[model samples]
Target chain A: MSERVVAAAEEGQVVELRRSGRRPRAVANGVRAAAILVALVVLAVFPLVFSNPAVTTIAFFTLVFMTSTTAWNGFAGYSGYIPLGHAVFFGTGAYTLAIVAQDLHMPGGYGVFWLVPLAGAAALVVAIPFGLIALRTRRHTFVVITIAIFFIFQLLSFNLGITQGSSGIQTPTPPWFGGAFNIPFYYVGAVILVLSIAVSWFIRRSRFGLQTLAIRDDEDRARGLGVQVGRVKLVGYVISAIPVGMVGALYAYFIGQIFPQSAFDPLFDITIALMAFLGGLGTVSGPLLGALVLEPLQQYFTVSDPSYYLIAYGALFLIVILALPRGVVPTVGAWIGNRRARRAAPSPAAAGEASGGAPGGTRYAATVRSGE
Target chain B: MALLEMEDVRKSFGGLQALSACSLEVEEGSIAGLIGPNGSGKTTLFNIVTGYERIREGAVRFRGTAITNSTPERVFALGIGRTFQLTRIFTRLSVVENMLVATQRHEGWLRSVLRPAGSASEHRRAMELLDFVGIARLADAPAGTLSYGQRKLLDLACVLVADPSVILLDEPAGGINPTLIGLLAQRIRELNRQGKTFLIVEHNMEFVMSLCHRVTVMDFGKTIVSGPPDVVRSDRRVLDAYLGTEEADGDEAP
Candidate 1:
């Protein structure tokens, strides 16, 4: 009932549809949310029960990728600015954590975990200048600029004295032992993941988020409508950097090394962008879903057969993207929405067939738009 | 009192001059019409007023304060709103979202981002405007699904949501059916009666002549005449400009 059909049929007054559809959709959304909560709870205890180093390691990296991808989506998804060099902030956070931990003379273990949020703060600072410069451009140019800036950071990390270059700065090891060692990182990563999702959820519904979406759709129009397009884009870009930066710091602690190669991975940007694209570019659940499916499979395949993993992974990505060009969440969402709309309507054909030849882009957009 | 004034504005694109020396004034609480041949710089003038373009030599004033070279959103914040020659509503946003984003009327700057996209009052107001425009039932649907006329209506509604004191509408009657055009004219008259100001750029002379309090005619990037609609309608210069420009004011769907 909550499904608002995009049918342009003037057959009858549509005012009644809004009244009937509201409550049912709300209940359905609540139920779906509850189910996801239960699933997240069950997934959180995975490392505790499995305790296998290999398994827990995969779980930990999955959480990291999920968090980073979702954070990336916060800006790129809404703003349509694909920042291919997000690792600039990611690297900055890693270096910041390493430098701060050393200068503070802090002991290793759970204490370093407290600095994860600090890592996010550091990323925010770097992002402001990066965003100011990069957000001025549009579309593919913006992507190219981000990639260019990324290389600059990568070079700095290699050449900078404080970063320790090839020697690689070391993070103090966790004082724990055995298979249980990965457990702490896994849980902490999980916590970061939850926090990132909560933040993302808020932004999706916020007025800022709507403005960002407007920017994505039409920057000039958004500007004419009184949106501070530049400010909104910059804020989205900066906000996206926080989780990635924090994840990078957490990653450094887990690996016990802050090598430029590991911390400022060029592949990192591609992977997160691909993940978000595969699941859904702008929707909240799309990135999380994409990360969940892709990251673990990526980790497992790399471990099981490193050579064939890339080939197989590449094949899968191509197939999914080609089959669902709009991405899985949106494609599937449109189908579900169409189905429900048909059910809700008095006449079956008016819901879908009547809206036939409505452009595919419009259907996808209709499915993704948060009507409430 | 002059609500918006542009003085001897000159704008050029590369070698061609779009606005040679165009000047205009819109009085408070009056509906003003800007009509010109195609490429006669009507839209360019609107662009400069909304801060989308920077004039080579000109001063734009809103309420006697210079606003030259200000940003577009800043211009809007200063109580001027504009619509495009081609309707530019966000295609992916819901019809209501199109209205709500213009609710910068609610927040001053970046503060609105922290608030929920729709408050009870804001949603109520958005829905009311949508209903006023006769698209209230379509509010929950993505705006892309709207027909061309509907999108034009939505564009106007989006601008009105900001409650700007002055609105610049470029071709509000273009491409829509005559019925919808009449509805649009009626709405504009009603809004103007309530003390809102309008600066409309239109090729539909009948709509402009019937609806506008004053008409400003442009030819070759210059304001040839400005006066009551009936006076400008029969002016020899206005007649020559239209005939010389291949009768560009004819019904040409943009």
Candidate 2:
């Protein structure tokens, strides 16, 4: 039966080659690598080309949100956890960096910069117990537990004397970057964004990632299939926390202060969820695309009209959820794939699929009948 | 000594007892069938042995090591594989990917990340297993696209991928056509001849009587009889257990 598929392919007819989706083409890989290289070069020269502090600041904020959103998507989107408390790690990172710089009285240069990863480590360590406890609860309960944890951390920041009783911790400047430290910070944000993308890509291709998707699809079946469900989830949560924490540490250094309100802000969680969902949850590029589109719109709205942006944000989320639940990338991706399949072999297989007559065509009808 | 043994195993859900002091043994290199009417606790016993359910009192021993409270993954790691009655295959994954995920060998997270799911050897093995189940053409298909009988074959192939010492199949022939049932029976016999032990929960008495080396009957969460198929088939206690049940028809023919 497949020999005929090969014959059709040889005659330049589309055979619907593989059942799941299109195979990864070498040309696509090349195109992707070139795109990343070009993006890196452009970002590397961004601060140099535009000396405007406002431009650099906007870029920094965009990158920061991008990093955090991608990190949140790593575990939550992929595993269908939908965490509403990633601010826990972000705030932890911010406070940890602030406390370390203040108490240790560390001078900048590489000395203070070296402590950034330690801040991330702090978040990762904290996430272990928190993730284990939170992940025990399924979807809705998990979201509530995460919110509870976020609030607990926020309250801790407010009451703890070491956090300066919510007045905020003033961060020390890195001594190496002479003037306009925002440029160096922009570069830091870019590096973190790249790392986020890299980690996301790695997870998407890994066996660990497959296990996560299986858990997302059906947790009990994943366990029955021999996946250590809890352990894998904790690992995902911990991996997610590290990047958010690192970005938080960098944000604190850029802003030069940390407070319970800003650091543990629920708005951050909202933005992360919106960004990931907007781009395409579970896809590696989804969160990145989402962050790029929404963050600048959000910043523009906040600058122009603060009250309206919140309303717009809520409205936009509702629209996306209602209309394009799979997000932009996957929806558009599937459309393009179907178009190509139709163009390649305009009538045969597609007609069979529509009519539910071909060998594997029943799936399409089942999908429609099931309304999933 | 048995390869898999459950001694006085007890399990309850809320106020309802599911398994009441159920004792059973599956010896090495033998095919055993667990036949019972609906709600007879056959699945509960399988769940308990596979660590999906915990036994209240009594021990489940795999190769002589007590593994009563082990997690599902832990039990799988200990070389006891199982299939679900409702077919728990990863529907979103490709058929080959589903097989690959069940590979018993553990890979470090870093290694897994660096190595793509399309490694040559794993792909070959996955394809081999898919072909072994007579669905090699569907290897690249999303498992959700498979027909019901094809999904059952995929489920069986998944358990076999781990190469475990003992496999517990929950209704391998239920809802399958006669042709596929014959194919499945042949495959089970072929695997058993190769020294793989099987404990099957089935309502198809013909399939059980013809393929199983031994058959055990259960009713109301209690083991009624365990012996050669002919002995168990003619036993008065076993007959009474199925007297008013739908399964009486299955026993009557064979």
* DockQ of each model vs. true complex: 0.53, 0.38
Q: List the residue pairs that clash in candidate 1.
A: A1-A21, A208-B113
The 0-to-1 C-alpha lDDT of every candidate, in the order given, reads: 0.84, 0.80
* TM-score of candidate 2 on Cα atoms, chains taken together: 0.90
Superposed Cα deviation of residue B17, candidate 1 (Å): 0.9
Off by over 4 Å in 2: A1-24, A107-111, A174-181, A346-354, A357-372, B104-115, B245-254
lDDT of 1 by residue, B1-254 (tens): 59999999999999998888888999999999999889899998988989889876989999999999898988988889888888999988878989999987547445766788888998999999999988897786677767788888899999988899999999999988888899999999999998899999999999999999999999999999999999999998998888853455454525
lDDT of 2 by residue, A182-244 (tens): 787888789888988888878866788878877887788777678888878988999999989
Q: Each candidate: RMSD to true structure?
A: 3.6, 5.1
| lDDT value, residue B98 of candidate 2 | 82
lDDT of 1: 0.84
